[model samples]
Target: MKKKKEPLKYHIFQNITFLLKCIRREHPLLLIFIIMQVILSVISPVFGIYIPKITLDLVMGSADTAQIFLVLGGFGIVMVLSMALSGMANEGKYIMYNDMRRYYQMELFLQSLSCDYKNVESEEGQTKYQRAMSTLRNGDWSGTSIMIVSSIDIVVSLLCFFIYSGIMSSLSPYMVLLLIVLSLISLFGTRQAQSYEYKQNDLTAAYEKKLSYVIRTGSNAAFGKDMRLYHAGGWFQELRSSLIEESAKLAGKIQDRYFASGVVNAFVLFLRDGIAYSYLIYAVSAGQITIPEFTLYFGAVTAFSGFVNGIVNNLNELNGANLQMNSMRAFLDNTNDPEPETPLALSDLKEYSIEFCDVCFSYGTDTGFVLDHFNLKINAGEKIALVGVNGAGKTTVVKLLCGFYKPDSGIILIGGQDINNFRKKDLLKLYAAVFQDIYIPPFTAAENVSMQELKTTDRNRVEECLVKTGLWEQFCGQPTGIDTPMTKEITGGIVLSGGQQQKLLMARALYKDAPILILDEPTAALDPIAESRTYEQFHEIASDKTAVYISHRLASTRFCDKIAFLSNGKITEEGTHDELMQKGGAYSQMFALQSQYYQNKEVAAAYAEA
Candidate 1:
């Protein structure tokens, strides 16, 4: 769905408030820039037009050389000072522009980082984030840094226009009148052109996302095997070309509209200039005005038109930039999932029992129920094995318990208090979750284990956990040891195999050492022998802590206190392996089928013995 852009009034207030806040930071430097602009604006016509006009009049008369030299020298001095002031302002503008842009860019990123986690997971939120990022990257820094400095230009331009227009009005009131009317016409045209360009940002961003993925996946070494084996390079190339062509077509249309408006505006100014010059020449020839008057009036005419155009153009550009800037503001202003204003804090974590009573849930942007009327409860220090085939809502229970999502109906309680009553940050202190999808950061092994920066990590604990989990044996012989980087994303870093990566993540979870632990297929990538070793280590480590284990290998569940067998989003059996085996339900049937291969091997051995 397309997002509706906010009104112009909203953008105007947002831009002014934002710029003022940024300006309040470095008023001294920005003030100097403004003063320079004012000085130059007042002096530009005096040197280039007014002083010269006075000297020319004296030269044309029956006058002495002393009078002429005096005026000429005044003009020369003003000329040098004006040029130097203009140079200073231009140099200052370039530096301040970059610094302010960087400031706002960082602010935008920080806002995104602190936004509601659940919102980040939603499709609409992701789309807004992408558009907001495009605004920052696209060089249209209106309503933020660029707008701050550009405001000074617009204000000064209007001030100069008024000063120059006053001079023109003295010569002829019609001169000022005609230019103002032309500026009005140009304003309408520019506004229309900018409106189209503003909407084009979204279209361009969408196409760019697709085009970038195609290029990245087609060329990345990670996808190299699939690209060649499937022979999908041609397909990627074709899709990339189509996206590029469509994006270019949309961009080309915007450029064409802008070019047309520019040409029309240029002609209008030329016509205005042509008429003023022609009218003044007639006056000079008819003796209604002198050569001196003609010279001053001609200069005034050109300067007059410039002021009009400058005011209109800056306003147009600022308004256009306002659209993109508002997008960035929208993303920042979006609050996270609604919750209590003042939340209750948790007590000492003696018992971390969890119960999900008649919970129902579906993803925010999706319609299908991942968990429907699901209910499960566990006492403190109970080792429950959650076993199910794929798509049986095993992992959903863990997600709800961790409060990653809230149930659409019913309640969850932790330590006999409603889970929702505790704040999100406080509630998360309860569990250490190791999921099927793991994020391996590019950092030293110690920092990855402790999940802290290098300085704050406890070396002794890091060493002990690594040793406990077999990761230390790999690192012990290296120069970096615990400091060794984990992923190849960093220089001097090494890549770990699938099993090593999984083990490293497991070590991180172990290091957290929270009261309750949830592990989903923690040994999925390990060999059977390695898997058995990890299972034994996990049980020993989690002996006292409440733990939930999920694995496709039913043989691993034999060690749990009780196995909760899930089928079609409900617990079909709750008992020990021996009890389930005797009952001969779905769990027993699946277990027997899985053991068939091992049983066949034993029969072959018996026949060979005979």
Candidate 2:
């Protein structure tokens, strides 16, 4: 379904209200500081225009020397005081802006972390996420800080416009009207330029996202070996160059529009100043107005033109800032399925039996179902192996069971209750999983195992899990023992082998000690014998927990109580290893082929060694 577009006024009001609430919550005094800065800024310039006129008029009139000195002294003192106050207010505003910018950035980060996992994985969702992140990262160009500053500019400019209009009217209302007309023409041109830039925002964001991806991938040490071995650096460079050239072309188009707007503004200013100055000079020479009055009116006319331009420019900037705010709000609002008003508590459940009934799921409307009418049941404390080839929906099944993705139809039940009944966070607490991909953060070994800070971690539990996973002796032999950092990027840190990293993940899962344990190809990095040994060790450690193991190595399924072979989005074969072999089906054939391949390889290695 298409979303209805919001009006410009609605976007402006809603974003402003949201930001004001943020300011109030984060720093209430910031608003006062901003207002103080604006008022002083406006007043200081007014004094600059009027004080000279007053001083000149006093000199030319019959005013005595003492009176002239008094006037000059008061003007100097007021100017100094205004400058000092403005400085203080500006300094305070700057500090507050930095604080608010950090607060807003953190809010965006938190929102990204908490949003639905499906959204994180989807293309449209990633685009929105990148756009929001890019908008916030460009602190001076767009986001909360720019929006707040642009809003203040509009208010200040409007205030100046009204004050200057009153001054200009004193000379002639016709002059004020002429200035307004010329300013409006310039404003129209500038607004056109701004609109063009606004329309290109999505394209610009796409380019930025691509450029960021290239830079990130190129710089990551993890990809360094692949790039070198495959000689792919030139390919990456060419891709980056192409993107940069295209982005530069787009930027050139935007700059051309701005340049045209500038030309129009310059022409309008030329006409306005020529007409105002010529009329004022004629009036003074004709003895209709005094020189002091001419000076005052001329100053007011020039300043009035500036005030008009300020209003136009600030309004354009405000609109741009509001557009970026809308992007961020859209991303933050893209939430997953709403939880029920009263979600079932995980603590109320005793047994952790899992069941999937007539379930169907697909990644998108255009994609075929990865799982269709898939039904499975695992009694409490039972161990099952789900064996399937790549893209056979084994991982999808695990993801659905873990509530990372919801099925399009049918139900997944846990302990006889619908999985949807539990809150996502609470549902996740019932299972501990180690998947194929591993990410070990640059933290101490103990922190990595426990997935907690040093202060809060149970040292004994972490040690116990490490020992069970066969990593305790290796860690203890290191200089820093379990306190050693896990990444080479950190000074005095050590990088683990792929096999060791897999073990670390296993330790993490064991530390959680949930009722259900899942290992999805988690031992892929280990040799076949080592992988089998690790699986056996994990089985012993999680003996009482309901276990689900997924692997293509059929030999490993021997230890499982039951083995279900998946094919074309359904379980096609199910039985113990001996039973499946005796049935002489697809599972039996695949297992025989794998066994023969491994045996031949072992013979070939032995012959080569001899």
Best by lDDT: 2
Alpha-carbon RMSD, candidate 1: 3.9
Query: Could you tell me every candidate's TM-score relative to the true structure?
Result: 0.89, 0.93
What lDDT, from 0 to 1, does candidate 1 have? 0.77
lDDT of 1 by residue, 58-111 (tens): 888877898788778877888888888888887786667666667767777887
> Model 2: what TM-score?
0.93
Cα lDDT tens digits for candidate 2, 385-475: 9998889999999999989999999999998889999999998998899998788999999999888899999988988989888888878
How far is each candidate from the true structure, as Cα RMSD in Å?
Answer: 3.9, 3.4
C-alpha lDDT score of every prediction, in listed order: 0.77, 0.85
How does candidate 2 score on lDDT? 0.85
